[model samples]
Target: MKISRIVLASVLMVPGVVLAGENARDHFRDEARAATGELASELMQALQAAMQEGGPPEAIAVCRDRAPAIKTRLSLERGWRVSRVGTRVRNPLLGMPDAWERRGLAEFQARHADGEAYADMEKVEQVVEDGQRFNRYLRPIPLQGQCLACHGDRDQMSADIRGILDDRYPHDQAHGYQAGELRGAFTIKAPVD
Candidate 1:
């Protein structure tokens, strides 16, 4: 969900401070939303195609190989850091949340616990890291019905799917998710101008 300019302006406003480039920050947030939406839609299309052609095992390969490629392509095209982070990661190299992301995930979880719909959850902020400032955005990725083939309960998963996951991710922890649960988040960080 895109944050409204009125809400952003209200949040950034201070009693005696002059804020600058409010629209620039809003543009950055919109770009992040567009990139994240593209990645999610593309991955879903690919996953659905793979599932139809070769079932759950092929879908796993698509996520393992193609997902990272998609993220890399988006990062190059947008010149921003774009990736997914999971609460329980299947591939730690790609899906592990960093410290800042962990904090964002915690915030998401807390909001969800307080009855906020996951579909409407998002966080946007600016922070300085190592003398560089960035606009960071996070949105939760809710697990859908189709995701159950690989991400659902392991005990009920097919043997082929289990075998592939075991071979590829010896230390996987991304299963046991139900529909509508928080699978992970799409995170984007663009340098502030």
Candidate 2:
């Protein structure tokens, strides 16, 4: 009877453990995402203003100049990334996608679907390659519309966009994307001091 009672208790607690873990992950992800959204909004506005100028040349200059400032404003000043997606280049991060996941992502985009945030519940569990613990959160960036052109389809890309991408991100692998697709995760890692 005791053995059965203990077993039942463990079984009952299993769901609670899973639920708690999910809640913790959600809390952490939400905090990081909320912070990132504020910064992204500012960057978007800046990029829009720059795009208003004469041509791509003018816009590039504006974005380039402001890039450093934005970085400074947010302490992601040192470690952060901005990318676009559909060119022929392949992304290094995409390298980690499981075969089935890669196919699922592709299908999701082809259908113009953007999974709900946490649909996949991605998180930075650890940085085994290097060294990290309890000190970081990984946040994924969803591809927004502005990110579609070069990141969506090479053949479908406009000459101007391709030109801009070529000129700016020559080795870019941020292409072949659709709105709301998972672009990459912000690997937030720090020393476990």
Candidate 3:
């Protein structure tokens, strides 16, 4: 009778534990979405302004310079590691994914191929690495019409834009993207209490 009672008590507590876990997951997911949205909004506005000021070539500076600064500011402000990583990188140093991130990107591609809409796609997990717990999040970034100016087919790109890209990103492999294709992801890592 004692054994049965103990077992029943344990079973009853399971839902509470599970509910707590689910709540934590939901909180982390909400935080990740808000942070990612903020970064996207700021970057898009800057890019639009840059494009208006001097076309795609001048807009390159927004990505090359301003984006990193904004990301750094966000990271510092939010106490999280937030950044973007590309599936095909122009600057490998800045855009290469770690092992876990590579798996996430592959999963994203598989989901996309299976007809999942990019706008609705995201991955979130509680991961433990090197004894530290983190809430990791990834959201797909689809190439838009404006993105085609810089990331579309090299052959279709203007000579001036190509010249600037060649000069700036000599090892570029981030081109050839069509509108609505997955360009990369916004990734976040936040500590979990």
Best by TM-score: 3
Compose the digit string of candidate 3's lDDT tens values, residues 1-193.
9999999999999999999999989988998899999999999999999999998878999999998998899899999999999989999988988888889889888999999989988999889999999999999999999999889999999999999999989999999999988899999999876
Cα lDDT of model 1 by residue, 1-193, tens digit: 2668777777777632533467677778888889999999999999999999999888988999999999999999989999999989999888999889999999998999999999888889999999999999999998999998888999989999999999989989999999988899999988876
Query: What TM-score goes with each of the models?
Result: 0.88, 0.51, 0.90
- Which ranges in model 2 have alpha carbons more than 4 Å from their true place? 1-31, 54-69, 76-115, 118-134
Alpha-carbon local distance difference test for all models: 0.90, 0.54, 0.92
Q: Which pairs clash (backbone N, Cα, C closer than 3 Å) in model 3?
A: none
Top lDDT: which candidate number?
3
Q: Which ten residues in a row have the lowest lDDT in candidate 1?
A: 14-23
- Cα error of candidate 1 at position 54, Å: 1.0
Pairs with steric clashes in candidate 1: none
Candidates sorted by lDDT, best first: 3, 1, 2
